[model samples]
Target: MNKLAYALLTCIVILSLSTSCEKDSIRVPVQTIELSASSFTLATDSVRIVVAQLSPNNTTDTNITWTSSNQQVAIVDQSGNVKGISPGTTLISATSPDGKISASCEVDVIKWTLHKGGLGFVEEGINAMALDKEGNIWICGQNVIKLGSQGAWLMNNSNLNPSAITFDNQGFAWIGSGSGLYRYDGSKWEVFTTENSGLKDNSIITLATDNTGRVIASHFNRESLLGTGASEFDGNSWKYYSSANGLVYDNVISMAIDKSGVRWFVTTNGISSFDGEKWKSYGASNVGVAHIGLVHSVAVDSNNNKWFGTNSGLIKFDGTKWESFTNQNSGMIGGSVTAIAFDNNKNLWVATGAGLAHFDGVKWKVFDRYNHPVQDIRTILTTPDGKIYIGTGLGLLIASLRD
Candidate 1:
């Protein structure tokens, strides 16, 4: 490039032609057409990238031509803006009006078609999502991932089968996997298992962080057939609870913390509420739990009302009465509810076996795979940045909760 610049300068000096035949007339050197980059590799999300940078700091010619060898692969405008059209390679050439001193850039476009993005992170079997202290999103699949604005990195916990994820009040992240409960304090990870911590069992299926920063986890205990209850950590010690300690069932799938600081656990038998001192059990007769065999998830709204997802339908209890919303009365396309989450706008996002349902307190909107990318959404979460993260059976997804 330097040699080319010197040659252009020599040509400019050897030329005796001037713009105007007048005394003390200034001469403009030949615009040395040089490109900043010789090649580029971009994604569908990065179509609006600069293809090349022209040299000759002072070139008043607005007629520089930018052309692509294959417009189907990529297209370049006169301003040197390159837009990737497909998953292929193309050569973008820039030429002067006189057809001299030309340069070219090879562009390769890649497509990253995931849930709701063009490219960034791609994974399968995503189930849970949580936010870190820096606002980065952590998604759970076969392992855990810390997804940020820059990109995504997996926090491999020895390939632990992560089932749930949550963030504590102190900005620490807790992951519940089949192996154990792991906590990440940004720098290091602390593992809690039956052999290490106060965990009654090693198969962690669900995790919940209370207002007091208590990390509560549910044990799956499916293989061993010995998981008797759930475990709780007060940032110092571990506590276990089961039928012997007031739970009606030992197979707990999900948990939630209400406004009154009560921890609710969704079990196969019923719902268990713990106030750090006492434990209360509610069944289908009192809490309006239907004949659903399995309770999938649990959540609490801003008003402290408890929400439960079951195979039959969605149940909501505002501390007094339990209301059951199914296909008969609500817009739930599928009767089996898998997960539920509340947005900043007080809207309830529900994931069922058939589609995704949104309730803004007045109406219901359903999004299925036929129209949207939603399919078998397993879990849902809304962050303060107004981004709704949904994990389907396929992979992780991001959607807008905007009306």
Candidate 2:
């Protein structure tokens, strides 16, 4: 009787131990892994957090490792966070600890910063933009906006509507308004008009700073029958020029100083060049163009080639020859070119009535509402830090370029 009881107890204990060992050895392996996003775009220095999901809720080995296909364009941390390094495309992946189950996302790293109408800007359009000595950007439309590291702030300049703005080498900002010309030295502001200065008229339409630190302002009165030419301020004295003097036209629209220190004044129907002592003129009949009055902006490239932005198209005068680029002849998206600027890579960026075009001297890329949120580009400017600022009717578009 004792032997039978002992044998039964031993069998019961052995069965219990076998059942417990079998239950503890059972496990559920990961079958599938998926990411939240399939693809997305990010700007340089920007970050995006991604999420990974596993097929089984009670996965035994849920550990994952995040990695980037191209670390130069983007990087991924162990927490599934991706940061853009430059402009390119990279694949971000989340893999299981055993490298069997994985999921991925295509990340397009672009150097683009878009500021919509009411986000950072007070208005919809930016008529002019200038960069100060401290690398701050100043824009004028309905109000004067200064954008820096601290963000954007409005400047109270007597509630004047600025038409043009320029910053001198001495860090002073000169703004031209319809009523008068104003100057600000970071802390103080001074205005000059027909009643106080040697300006021929009270309305100033354009402003530019020469290499010698002289501020040049052009007056274009909409109420008057004709324009009042331009004025030059050499920090202490003022000099006036008009049709009665040596200027080719009294209605100056824009001015540009070439690399050789020659000042070029562009009017509605003519182009004037002054080399400090002599003045030369080029009109529609002389330049072989149909209508020179369509010219709206002028830019000088690194090679000293003069490029003109006109309503009809873009014109280039390379000293001895002239060339034209229009929608019918080139890949330009629009026929009316509003603004033109050259970047550090010598890429010509043109803002037109329809879209924004970029010319890398070999190819052309046009961006519009289909690919971007830009429309009605009014002005464009490039900074030394490889940033391109575009003022449009929608808002301000800032693009950063790497190589």
Candidate 3:
């Protein structure tokens, strides 16, 4: 009786233990899912890994399916890695295999968002860049390239050898080229020359528009008979000015108009300003303390202050006073200033032969090949939305200044 009772009791205990172990190993359903990030931004052709946390930590089905709402904007693999394809917004979701529990993250993909350039596209570097009324970027090189929501596209303006471009008050694009002045009204292109319009010469080089809706064109010609000068067009009539008139030099490098409608022109030797009736010229000799030499570009800020970019440094003239900044005193990256522009936040961005310099009215930030991928910056332009378009010898460098 003792052997039978002991065998039965051992079998019952062993069976009970086996049943308990099976119950402990049973699969548990996931109650919730949480992602490591709620929102993030990534550049085009960039990737980021996000982790998912499942509730009921001991759930047996821990597998997650990653998906993107817009594959053209972004793509998510099975392992929760998100890759940006283009510029737009997309939703990335991590869901349980059964599709009941899920978590999502908002992703913003930007193109040329980082320290990237248009190497193969904008070959030979971008000669000039401009922003249209719709916030589209128009770049001139060997050809015309447009960067907008549809991406980059070539305009190929019939090999006109476009040198400069500007937008008029009506949003019409006025391009100065080797042959003549070309105007684009968003659809068609029209050419203006000495024979067709009021222009005295056909060789247009630099162009600018004033707040009064007038287009100013500068022409450079080496021929003894053709000459070099600048022209003003008021939609109906043309007025010509040259060194023979009041300009300090005939070869104008760049031009800009101040807030008071005074046109400022920069030449290789000096600076000139015309107020529709009189022309005033300034040189190193007349402007005391202003290191004005080999002036490459000129820009008028919102305060009507004239900023000149020169081979030696930068000069600011407030009509009565003059100020100068160079690599020796300021944090300018390069000695030779090529271009200058102001952003939406009133930050001044300067392009030089060596690198790019940013001045925030109090502090200065220099970006060169050592810290940034861009160097030999030829031109810099800032849009209203805080995008900085830099044209360099390597290519076109695009960056954002938004906080």
Note the clash tally of each candidate. 0, 0, 0
**lDDT tens per residue, model 3, 1-403:** 6999999999999999999999998989899999998876676667889899998898976987899999989899999889978767789999888888899998766555322345326466677889999988888777777788878877663776677888999999888887888888988889898888888778777888986779999888846534387999989899988899899888787899888888898887788899989999998888874568688988888788888999889888998998888989887877788889999888888888777777877766665543355566767789887678887666777775323
The candidate with the higher lDDT, 1 or 3, is 3
Per-residue CA lDDT of candidate 1, range 1-403, in tens? 6999999988886664442344334433346666766765554434444444445655544367888998877787888878766666688888877777678877755443345322333457887888777878888887777888897787873777788899999898888887788888879988888898888888887888876898888887667765557898998898888888898788888898888988898888778898889988888776645644578888998888898888889888898888888989887768888899998889999988777777888767665543345567888878886667878777776664221
In model 3, which runs have C-alpha deviations exceeding 4 angstroms? Answer: 1-122, 222-227
lDDT of 3: 0.81
Per-residue lDDT tens digits for candidate 2, residues 1-403, read 6999999999999999999999887777888889998876666777889999987888876788899999999999988888989887789999887899888988766676777765466677778888888889898887778888888878754568888899887888888998888888999888898899887777888887866788889888778657779998888888887878778888888888787777778877678887778888877777887646557888899999989888788888888787878888787887778888998888898988777777888766666543445667778888888778988766788876554
Q: In terms of TM-score, how similar is model 1 to the real structure? A: 0.68
Residue range with the least summed lDDT across 10 consecutive positions in model 3: 113-122
Q: Per-residue error at 131 for model 2, in Å?
A: 1.0
Top of the candidates by TM-score = 2
Score each candidate by Cα lDDT: 0.76, 0.81, 0.81
For every candidate structure, what is the RMSD over all alpha carbons to the true structure, in angstroms? 18.0, 11.8, 11.4
C-alpha lDDT (0 to 100) for residue 314 of candidate 3 = 87
Regions more than 4 Å wrong, model 2: 1-120, 400-403
